[model samples]
Target: MPAKRKLKLVITLIGLLVLGGGWLIVSAQNHPSSQPAQQTQAKSKPKYRTLTLDELHHDPTLTYCSIIYYTVKHGKIQRWQEVSKVSLGWQIEQYPTNDGFKVLVWPDMNIKKEAKQLQPNWFALTKNDSVTYHSFIIHSFRDDMTATTNLKTIVDQINHDHAAMKVRQMTPKMLIVKHKNSAN
Candidate 1:
């Protein structure tokens, strides 16, 4: 009888220990205590803008733009995409104010010949290139309110400042659209 009682006590103790071990393992798996994560940990993040590639095409004033904003990334731009629509020289973007374009032309004097000769050259560049009527990528909070305004404004401002066209020759008040590169 005493041996049987002793055996039962030992088994109960072992079972309890096994159960406790199992619970600890499960708890550890569910929530690791060693590696803690804070809700307010600081992280470096990149700023992004909503932009459309189309803005460059429609604007009447801009003869050309270089380095327009492509698709935005969640974090800091690690690398530039191959600038699918246009070359690296120019790109389109929307400013919050959309007040106007801030053109940083090299030798600011180029603005004169740039407007006259640049268009024809750029147009020739797109001679047989664009697959679409205009390859535009629009990004906006609402589909209606687009950042397209900025590109046009910037180009217009440049035009107003330079009063030049990429196309060399033109008729009176003729609306000219310069294709920066050949449109396939």
Candidate 2:
């Protein structure tokens, strides 16, 4: 009888230990410790980067610009289409108001002559290709705007210009609607 009693006590103790071990495992999974959770969140974070307007304007490598032109009423429906892209020069200056750009352009002699004939006001002091010439298009925006937003405003002004025909005779204003540098 005593042996039987000892055996029952040992069995009950083993059963209790097994249940306690299982409960500990489940509790650990359901309620993770605060330190590890916070550590994991801290280890994984996000970063954002953007270019400033000044930096973008001064970039020499950004020498090319796509252009598009449109007329309000050429005695009929307004004819609009993309035109030849132009290459810019190293000289770039900010307007006195700090709201626009004066970029130097070295157009091919033929194009330059044609442009000179089209809009004499666009010509700077230099008429020949040896020196820098500024045929600037004005752009203005809030100081806090991003570079992309500034570019969008420039494009909008180019497209919406009522005197585009008078300025360049539909030689495509100084902005683009859709143009990809890639051939593909």
Candidate 3:
């Protein structure tokens, strides 16, 4: 073979090798299988963390007072309990008063009247005038069990903390009747 032709062939082979190597690097960078495991796992994690009662209260979106009921036991409430620093996503707001916690649950697309009925029960065990009832339909239960359980836990904590707390129980049936009658 001629020396000039041999040189041309060698140069072409070198150029092809360089182009193939560049293509492989670019393809590996774009493929997820070639990425580090940590990066892929991080992306799969949730963006929003579960908020606790304290965190939920400070949230800017919770504004409406959806429920307004007070427990009418024989004794007066001493003081309300403070929330912890833990993070959770129990989308509800609570305003503690001398009578009881005025719970304001967050808005939801699947809100039901039955869930609203569950609110007053958290304050009082039975049906009676002690558990007052006044709520609108703006906000409903995000997680009914979570909302009720948290409310009960907070109220219980507050009552437990106060030495002179007078907790009461009312009849659920009577309270429902009163609530319906008053709605007129």
The C-alpha stretches of model 1 lying farther than 4 A from their native spots are 32-66, 69-184
Which candidate's lDDT is highest?
3
In Å, residue 178's CA in model 2 sits off its true spot by: 11
State the lDDT at 127 in candidate 2.
16
TM-score order of candidates, top first: 3, 2, 1
Q: Give the CA lDDT, 0 to 100, for residue 21 in model 1.
A: 100
In model 2, pairs of residues that clash are: none
Q: What is the lDDT of candidate 2?
A: 0.31
Best by TM-score: 3
Model 2: how far residue 152 lies from native, Å: 25
Q: How do all models score by TM-score? A: 0.25, 0.27, 0.34
- Among all windows of 10 consecutive residues in model 2, the one with the lowest summed lDDT is 120-129
RMSD of 3: 15.2
For each of the candidates, the C-alpha root-mean-square deviation to the true structure, in angstroms, is 18.5, 15.8, 15.2
lDDT computed for candidate 1: 0.31
The per-prediction tally of clashing pairs is 28, 0, 13
Find the 10 residues in a row with the least total lDDT in model 3: 80-89
